[model samples]
Target: MAMSKFWWKSDSSKDKSIHWMCWSRLTAAKCKGGMGFKNLRDFNTALLGNQAWRLISFPDKLLNWDPTLSYIWRSVMEAQALLVQGISCCIGNGQTVDITNSPWLPSIEDPFVHSDNKAISNQKVISLFKIDEKAWDIELVLDVFEERDAELILSIPLTENDKDTWYWRHEKMGHYSVKSGYNVIQASKNQPNTVDNSRFWRKLWNLKIPNKARRIQVNAQCPVCNLCDESAIHSLVTFSFAVECHQFSSVKQVAGDYHIFTEWLQMVFEQSNNRDICIQEDGLEQWCPTSSNSVKVNVDAALFTDPNRYNYAIVVRDHLGHLVQAMSKCSLGKVVSRAIRECRHQRSP
Candidate 1:
């Protein structure tokens, strides 16, 4: 009597076989390979760090404090701190301190001292500091600077006086408010000149969209899919395929009717994979026959005069050189009819 072998009966044996198979497949040809395995704990730690950095770098986007605001104050502050720290490190022998104390170092003397040790007298320092503070106030002056720079670059109709007036008006106006009397300062220490008022009205009226409103519009839809839900690159590239598949399935009645559509959909989905499965320039099709199945599947890209449109066709032929089933015209009817016609033709021959 011959001894019978139960190969997968033992857990340890099965586990070992599975492990060996996995590694063997990974080292296989690029076209026929398994997922390359990584240390799970290390990967998880790296992923967690990436998430933390994203959160820190895009606080407003992640936190949803004000959906209408594009700039994240906290993130910007963090970035500024990072910049100051880096600059301080480069200039000050790797010592990290407050921006004011380390690199900025305001002088206790009649004049404040810069990192360069330039002696700016108290009165001169105070005046320069005030002007510099106003000019460098990122939140207050960025919009003004951008607008003026754009006008200058584009060669828009504006004189030096007009530009100065516009700047002064913007300084007086401060930040915008959707409230009335916000711009009307009857009298103040920082009152704008009459020329500034004239430029202010012209520029303010010309403003097509408010930054806040623009931000709101931009954030209304998901960045990836342009859907209302949370837009993620993974969702658009990966999960959306499943969603589109489900949508296609809902419309398709027959099983194999969706084969070509699914294949095309997958090609579109995995486009980032950079593996060109389309028919090449030589007009040759990718025809590979499998021994396990007598039927041969031919995948080819259909060409049209229009370059913008992408149309693909997949055909499955029976072992007897007959088309048992077919789908075309973005519907199941054409393929089914083709299949029937081929079947009848085979019978007749």
Candidate 2:
């Protein structure tokens, strides 16, 4: 720690005012409102934790005469103790998991330990899995747990392996590394700063569309305002006349001066929107010929310069390139009938 402070002072050339932010704040991650400086203390702890985990998980390796007798090994034990705070076990055949104590369940709360059956105290989770249907033995689970807890246990996927796998919750794919360890430490201390402009922006987004989220659904266009495509993020946050409404509300100065969308939501929302923008119908490669016995329907529409009008067409093709059905339509009035015409003129399906 002293060596790091010495290096910091040398790097800064003894300029006190130019340091601007404190050492701790600068050491945080950018996403968590830090300057991206590496937190050496956390970094050291993370590295030590990895070694400690290895020693604890594997004891028979090198230096056979009691590894804990050494100072380095003892220091590593301290780091390992801290690392276990963020560790959880993924239930497999569940041989290694202690069902009552291990942090295997996905819920925020620990597994309920007040089971009426004392026999299950040390039993492996795999004992509860039914191989026939590749699912948990629901009756046995319900015997030990309430309905809600039983549902959560059943949701976790069980593997055919003979042992459970340990995972660092902060890391990806259940694999631990020094970088992830450092991140875990930093996140433990991270506190949201509401003074920043980003905080106010987060509240503006309308995220109450639970129905669409549950059914894996999204609307083609904004439900309240038909001009822009409706999304769970940006479009939902705004009405069609947001500018007018905000301007009229006497808060235009505060709203217009800031950039669009909230700070935290903007970064995440844009990334999700970009992934779905790929064109699935690229060309003729996607067009496969109909099967010998079954017919295929092909429908397409062309948009017109008028917002209310469209030159729409639909056709069905047979296995032998025969036209089984055909239809065409165009709007004759100012009404936005392109969508309505497409649905109603579908051969009354």
Candidate 3:
């Protein structure tokens, strides 16, 4: 948070106070309702955690260096402390784990702590199990721990040769990343999300009120229908021209069944591969084909005049002119790499 203050100070000489929302609020998504800025403190923490994640993820891949060579190794050891809460050990061979001392146990509550004084020093967790039977030594576990702890420990799977590995529990897959870790940390906070983005869709549906004319003092009414009091429902359904369009194409649309414009449009437009759209492709440039075996990405940023918001759309296509992926999202934060990364995730399976 101090870092945020320092940057704000450096950016201005006078009138330094941010006129809009505070830095924290601005970090929220516009749909959840804020101006959309990155929370620096959380972001920095995630980045540092990611660095530590890399070190642990590939133990053999780490570079060898002496403490006299650099202070980087010391920094990593310090950062590992923050990551402890979010990660857990995936018991593989279970050799490296100290059963009583390690956080490798699953139970979150402080139930029972087994006396490790009599236990053999550096004893592998596998020693408590019956290897021949491929099962936990239930009698021994019960002696060492309460029933709850015993059951949890018994559930852990072990292999003869596989080494114990780290598991980042935050993600569905056990993979760890700074962006995903950042989002996971952010989700832990119990922030109230009061904004309803669908209200804007409702606004779009009630176009009978002439939103453009009222807001801009200009008469921007429905051009195709030519109705003096044209609404989204009337323009898309009830208009004589629209009924003619439906007649021309064999499709049934029950008027007044859809209260929201988006739902109604989805019903109309969602065909397997065949779709017809009336909206014009404004400001679209000519398309150019890519080399064979290459994927083509097309991206565009748009502004909504009424709500006064910015959004971006990403579409991926194969060289054969087939659509591979399409994604549209409200611009949450500024980073081109983040935008492209999200696009790839949304790409067609």
Candidate 4:
């Protein structure tokens, strides 16, 4: 029967004929009522791939990879040697060598080679060598040198109050290096480039704090009460006014039908707590009067004694309008017929 249904002709199957319609509502961007389809799982994977590539490439500034010293070591060693010679001459010349004067040296404890009457002393030379080693360590070099996306780096010239300030901005643009120094580089698809300086200037000029402040102030007011002090929890749970809203009343009315069985059970338990209720050995549904100034609740055994009969459970309420007790007959089966009646009773009337 199930196999036959697979090939069964139906009006619903006509729409499912096209695979694109299964995922989306339209076909093309310009088409009226055309649904755009997107595979969320594939989109998520692609986004994650871009992030992973970014992490591996830009390990220097983003990951704090200090390659400044290493790059200098490979390309500008001669310049560094000249700087060292200048430092040595400055210290050797009779000018008082205050360790604080040298920018190359990181600390005051750095040792210097003092020339004793033109010839360099061996002890002072060794101290100078030690200081040089320590200075090299302070240059900030990374252990590993991995090439990163160059185009991702760019310098943005920002002006606040007619002051020129350049800021570095890095972002992934596939395989391209987005550095600010390159004039040939094109701006992002949505972003305006240097060629459109007029639009860019307008955007920068319109960037006022009051606009953002206005937006924040608009959303700052509570949706429920229009009060600034009203919060999410206050609107949903604690607010007495919120509970009186029409929406809450409508929701409660809809929920009442779904919780009928559970609500009835609760009422029964509450009633039994304050009143006397009796359960017959044979399952039956009945009511009896009590004498302890409590609501009376009783059950007859005939309801369950019949082997092929189905009976409904009864709920009893107290004078205070609270549910006081409930009783139900056992199932019409042999297991319950011989088993002791297990009637859970409570009183909270």
Whose TM-score is greatest here?
A: 2
TM-score for each model: 0.17, 0.46, 0.44, 0.14
How far residue 275's Cα lies from its native spot in candidate 1, in Å, is: 18
lDDT by residue for model 4 (142-229), tens: 1111112111111111122222111112222223122221211111112444233455545554566554343333465554334435
For candidate 2, write residues 224-309 as lDDT tens digits: 44555655433423543444444444232232332356643454344445554333555333556788988888777766665657
Give the clash total for candidate 3.
0
Task: Itemize residue pairs with steric clashes in candidate 3.
Answer: none
Instruction: Provide the overall lDDT of each model, using Cα atoms, as 2-decimal numbers.
Output: 0.34, 0.63, 0.65, 0.33
How does candidate 1 fare on TM-score?
A: 0.17
Off by over 4 Å in 4: 1-178, 181-205, 208-228, 240-349
What lDDT would candidate 4 get against the real structure? 0.33
> What is the TM-score (0 to 1) of candidate 4?
0.14
The window of 10 residues in a row where model 3 has the poorest summed lDDT is 271-280
Better of 1 and 3 by lDDT: 3
| Worst lDDT 10-window in candidate 1 | 162-171
CA RMSD of all predictions: 25.6, 20.2, 22.5, 26.8
Tell me which residue pairs clash in candidate 2. Answer: 221-230, 222-230
